[model samples]
Target: METELLSYAFSGLLVIVFFISIALAFRFSDGHVRLRKRLKSRLIYGLPVGSMITIVTVLAVYLFLQGGIHDWDNPVVHPFRSWSYFYPTGTVASGFAHGSPSHLTSNLTTTLILAPIAEYIWGHYPDGQGGTNASRDQPWYRYPIIRACVLFPGAAFVIAVLTGAFSLGSVIGFSGVVFAFGGFAVVYYPIITVVGLLVVGVVRTILDGLVEPISFAGVTSTLPGWTSTAVQGHGLGFLIGVLLGITLLYHRNKRPRIFELFVALLIYGLTRGLWQIYRPLGGNEFVLYRALGVSVVLIGAVLVTATVVASKRPLFEGSSVTQREAGVISLVAILAFLIGPGIVTNLVIIDYHDEPADDELAVEDYIIGYDENAENPTEFVFDAPGTDETIERTSSGVYVASDQRQLWIMDTSQNQLRSTGTADIQIGGIGWRETVTAERDGLQVLGAQSVYAVELRHDDQLVTAYESNASTANIRIDNRSISFAPDIDDRFTITVEGSDGVEETASIPSVNESVEIGGIMFRASETNGTKFISAERDGTVTTVAQEE
Candidate 1:
């Protein structure tokens, strides 16, 4: 406890020093002149109230709605994902809901840094300037407080809803909105937005260190971070934000340099994983198009550059619309094309006839089961033209399916459950949540597959959902083979089968123990980091079962 306290104190001190150094640098830099002048003129009027309110709202959703306050690490995530267009609750809450505390913190941290910059571009006062407009003829939106509190927050909420609605699949997290903030900021301050991205990385690292000053980990397997990313959702949010920013710029008669805009868009796309265009081939498989993704990013940068910096002259000799206007129309068309397919896909009703497993446990509307290489219950089935390859995909894991929400997902993969030994699935709606724990117990045997059983526990109700067949070892003693099998009582038993058609069964002995069955003594022992069971008969010993 004392060591932890000291580590926290040291981390806090380091954070303070880092911020102080930043302050000192800003104080000495000549670039602070305009910022200082703006600050002095606006005083508290220019404060990022909208950004603060948005951040607070997101935090509140995570804390209360997602059950983060009760359990900081594990939140009710499955129910809050944007599962389908039919599920209104999920679609609405998905924008604010987070899968984990780290996810929420990383997103909010980026928002904390970039949102204020985007808000600054919007400004608190009307006329696109931070100045008091006391004229009665001024519109209500021109009021500083109204713009700071209402307009900015309202626009942000709209953006969030749009992102959720257009997202490709059942997606959760505030990253889409974070990317929107980046998109908006990059339009007005291209280079500064890049700098802000670096700052975000530093801040997130500091925060992680503060939370866990020391962490120990062993080599483990996990899917690549980019594999699961919703790149289409991110692209949609960024494009929408860029459109909004460009519209505002046009109205304000302002345009950033073409080269700067292109560079910023390209860099941001590459760094933020927007260039990771991929398609899920079900199970844990994905096909990534790296070359095509990079090409798309390059083309996007060029299009955005032309949209913002094109000349006011007509596109051709006698065209009425200007070149910039044409570019804007083309950009809007591209957004429509990107969103149309998602809308169509979401409208299709989910068919819930597919059963995940024969031995599924029903809790309310959820079906929990264990299966190996079963078809994904929630995956949308569609055939690609001119493709002979089977698009059918399979998953092997503990899965949870909900017909009402159109959710079919593997809550924990087989290998993951094997490594962790246990997993928890959180299910809930509006005001209530329940947890179902999946536990795997297994016995490894030498030269054979492991014998295992999967059990589910909800509250006090425990059930063995699935069990594997008994596995026999290759090594034999006195023409007798040893096999391991899982029993209904959640215990493993060792069976000795003799060539003479005699069999003896007994519970597997613990380490350093022995059990005599049919004149053959089975002893469990460990040596040189290997645990094995040995059979002794007539003063002769032979290895039977060993840990894989």
Candidate 2:
């Protein structure tokens, strides 16, 4: 009984839309095609209205099917009806569907405003001269309605049965219908709702996490994107909208059809690329995501190569941004490219060093990864020198490279002795035996010394004064090989060689510069910042300075 009523109502609605569109089309022009074009615009305007109507009408019918809108007049039989679960496929449309009069009237008001408008536009489609001026002559109505009637119920049913997901059956509404209306409009259609969602994201986050989460531009609540549940459908719908927009630019003529197809495909690919990066997926689909990512990378690479070879001036001019829109878009594009692993070259670096080949490691908050087949790297450790400074590095090998001039080597793995050499013959560090890194400049420690001294930086203005107590043996040099300062800052990491004549070797980062037994202190006679800031018994503080 309910199905019959719904079928009758739908048929009637379809008839009304068809007649109105055709009547309007004919009234506008004697030439049917010309009139159809005129009607197309109106359909564009009315599609949303029709879609809104479907929101109401479908809800009412759905209620009846669920037995909720039972023949209450004859209270003997009332049907069961209620809200449904979320289904990714059709929830947006289904959301509009409801269980009773309250639902129908609620949606119908909106439907009245949005659905009829679209249906009215369906009236305009080319038909033979002296055509019936009805659904018979309207391709717009036939194609859209036919597609919706077939696609919606059928897709929902098939998907539900196959997946054993009953939620699919519970789906309702006009979104899919409106989508169809929009699909026919421009294919690149722009929906205001999407932009609204993006704007609301910041506001929504603020309202949601009341306990103070993240803030942006003084706005205490903002989500980091990915958290939005409706993001997927909204995204897909947006893509369809844009595609419709592009389709509007398509020409049906056979002559330019091939070219138009190429342009359309290009637009689709580009848009899809944008979508993929914009909507990120997690590691579950590692293989698929990486494959797709690589494909995009290759495409972009080809474009870049072509651009380089073509030899044209950069549109930005490099001095300053010529246009604000262009500047922002360019910045966003650059950031996306960089983050997507596009800025890398074969002769390049993941950071200042090559990436590791194996699975990436999450050390603290830092994530380091290499190209798929790139070389693996050792974990990094910092190198501490003098009193307070430490240099961060990538390799475990203890080495320093301030300039390209020299490398300093501390046998970090060996506590017995620290070593250094001229980066000339053996370049010091890298040897196949224990594993080391060789650079241009390095310092050498004799036998087992307390500290392997090397010139960190020399700054002498012809006549400079350096004060020192026993604690600050501030070393000064006019021009020298190298020297080491007491590792006063971090006592734990200070590598000490032995106890006796200031000779000891320990672990990493700590420089072994000892004076007393088991202690590494300033060897320099002057109190310079290079080693330590010391005060004599008289309570006078002194410092040592270095020149670049």
Candidate 3:
């Protein structure tokens, strides 16, 4: 606790130092005159009301609605993810909800740094930008407070809902909106946006290092880092933001340099892993198309650059439509093409609502089970014609499925549990949350298969969910074979079978102990950190089982 407090203090001090350095640099720099002028004018008019509201609302949703106040680390996350179009709660909340405190903090931090910049570009007082205004006419809706408090926030909310509704699958985070803020700021202040991205990274690194000053870790199995990213939602948000930024810039009769916009978009896309275009081959397998992704991002950057920097003159000598108008139409068409697939995918209803399997545990709307390799229902939920044969999805390990939420995901894989021996699965909704712990206990025989059992514990109830087949060692001792099997009470039992129909079974003895069964004495012994079982009968000794 003392270490943690000191770490927090140090982290806070670093943040303060960073901001002070930035302030000093800006104060002395000649290039910051425009920024100073903007700030001076904006400060007297109003604050970044829309940005503050968004940050507060996102934090409130994560803390209160997702039950993060009590358990900040392990909040109710499954129910808040955008699962299906039919589930209104998930569809709406997923945009604001976060999977973990780290996720929430990172997104809020990005927003804190970039949102104000975007809002600054979109000034509190409209001056023929974003919307039309009559000359010297002050409309009631054109008030600074109205633009800052009402219009901006309202636009943000609508965008959030749209992002959540059109996201490819169950995604939970504020990152989509964060990307939107980045996209908006990049149009007017491309260099500043990139610098802000770097600052956000540095801040996250500092916080992480402070939280964990020293660490100990071992090798563990995990999927590719990009597999979990909600690329579709992020792309949609960024495109929308760019569109809005360009529209505002056009209305205000201003345009950024073409090269600057292209470079900024390209750099941001590459750094943010937007170039990771992947498809889940299921069973913890995924395939990423690096070349295709890079090409797509490059083309997208070129198109956006063209759209923003196009001349107002007509596209051709005979045509009335200007190049800028044609560019805007092309962008709108692209956005529609991007959104149409998601809408079709989301419209499909879940069909696998059968009763839970015998070995599966049922808790309210959730069904938990352990399986080596089972057909993943969520992958097939959207039965796109001819795609089933191409995308065969399978899952292995402890999984939780819910028909209502249209969720079927492997929480922990079989290999992970075998190495770690334990996992906790969090499941719940709205006002409540619960954790189901899965434990793997077993003994592996040398040169043979392992005998094991998978058990789950929730509240006071303990269930042995799965038991593997008994395995016997290949070696024999005095015409008797030794076999190991997992018993009901979460322990291994040893069985000795003789050639003349004589057999005996007994619980495996503890270390440095011996048990006699059917005239064969089985002794569990350890030497030089190696554990092995040996049998002695009629002055004959032979090795039987050993830890693998």
Candidate 4:
């Protein structure tokens, strides 16, 4: 029922945008003397509306192949939906992909609102049908969007890669490029800031409750649902845009000061490269949040220094933006802003992460060499212990195998395996060396040292239930109950009954201590820089081992 409502809402929003764009396209296409042959002006009026049509069409195709409106995080679609432009498939496809409806709307509101004004400022060629006007106040390149379309992707790619490599996370969405457009418009006309702030503020207010949470301008919040602002991406794009503005818009006739330009470029490159290699921007607590602050400071400093040094000519002072033009553009953007959020809200309101289990293949279908001749088709059949003992398949293409007291979880769809509870451990806190249970409804893996659970409703997203950064020793799992000591301070027990799971934490008296409860003894100790734990059953030492 909820899915149907959401789908209808999304379709309705798209329909609205479709009609608006068509109307605007017709409006600009009309044969008024004021509109005819004014290629630059016509484009400024039409490009954003036309872009909306393109966006809607592509998103409709994405919705179809994804099987639903809320399949935002499909792995195959993710590569194309967001900008991971450093990779081969991400470069050309990033611009077309959006993760969620809110993501699309936020970026769309900014772009559609600001892009027309930017186009008019940079692209408007007044002398109709004539050749290029060298004497015009603007730069020689008439179409700013052409240059912007090229630069925005490159900027997004660079910033996303740098952030992923140096900072805490990678970025997606059109916000960064929208910031670029904003930066360009602001540089061209400072008065645009008033309108820019008002629009973003109003749009954010109306839509903040509908999408991921956002912090106000000065306050900092990293709570759940508070999406990352991607400071690095936005900063990079803004800086690049500012540089372009200085070069093209500010100094029309005089030669650019090469030294200042070099300095500005060098500072930007150096900061980004260093942030990637050795991110020192953040102090201890603010490390994850420092990228944007650093970028803002550096970009501002570079812009100031460049304006002082490289700007040989005065700022462009051609035709001032009239009140009538500003009002019209703002009105168009307001309509887009109002419509965009509804589309995003409908598309992302329902989480469709867990699909039905009707497509379950036979357990033997995934067993290797089960039907093959026992006679050697290949040289190695190397059967190991525990491999044949316990093997199970969950509905979500997850295979759980216990081999040599180690548990392995394999995703058949991606051909990836994560092994735990062995001598070799991938995560630091927990050690697993026993049979692991794979639940079907949500496909959670329960082991001695670690517990992996996926939220079926959240697109099968993997979430850690019990993980510690410190080494966890004295692991034990019995009758679907798990207990382990993490570092020197505390002990934790995880209990599972049927499909429900819960965890409880208890404090320890000292580094070396033992607890006895309900005919069971759990002890923790350390020797030779290694943690150890032992379980006692009915006054007998049942298990003793080193923490993995």
Scored by TM-score, the top model is 1
Residue by residue across 87-145, what tens digits does model 1's lDDT show? Answer: 87888888888988888998899999989888888877544445655468878877778
Q: Where is model 3 more than 4 Å wrong at Cα?
A: 1-37, 43-46, 128-140, 216-221, 352-358, 379-382, 385-392, 500-503, 525-548
**For model 4, how does the per-residue alpha-carbon lDDT over 1-548 read when each residue is reduced to its tens digit?**
76567756665665677679878878786565444345444343434333444345445534543222534433123333222212323333444345555666666666666655555444434222223333557554444444334433344445333222221222345554555555555555545543655566566664553343333476554432322344444554554455455455534443334454444343433332323222222211222334754564555545444453432232344636543334334434533442332222112111111222322211211111011011111111223332221122122233322221122233222112223321111111011111122221111212333322211111242222122332233334353243433322223332222113544444322338876543356576777855554556656664443433
- Steric clash pairs (candidate 3): none
- For every model shown, the clashing-pair count is 0, 67, 0, 5
* Candidate 3 residue lDDT tens string, 1-548: 97677767776777788789999998888777765566646532335778998899999988888888878887778888776787788888888999888888878888888888888888765662333333457776666667677777777778888888887766788787888888888887888888988988887776776666545689866677788788878888888888999988888888887788889999988887778888777555788999999998999889889989998899999899999999989888888876865665565455556577767777889888898776677443556663443323575789888888776767888888988789988888887778899999877775689888889888886777788888988877777777899899638888888898677899878889999987788898988866777778888887777654
lDDT of 4: 0.38
Error of 3 at 417 (Å): 2.0
Looking at model 4, residue 460 earns an lDDT score of 40
RMSD of each: 3.3, 25.3, 3.9, 18.4
Candidate 4 residue pairs in backbone clash: 81-97, 101-344, 353-459, 421-432, 421-433
Whole-model lDDT, candidate 3? 0.79
User: What is the TM-score of each predicted model, taking all chains together?
Assistant: 0.90, 0.24, 0.87, 0.40
Give the poorly placed runs of model 1, Cα more than 4 Å off: 1-6, 19-36, 39-44, 128-136, 281-283, 348-358, 379-392, 510-513, 525-532, 546-548
Deviation (Å) of 284 in candidate 4 = 13
TM-score of candidate 3 relative to the true fold = 0.87
Q: How does residue 86 of candidate 2 score in lDDT?
A: 21
**CA lDDT of 407 in candidate 3?**
69
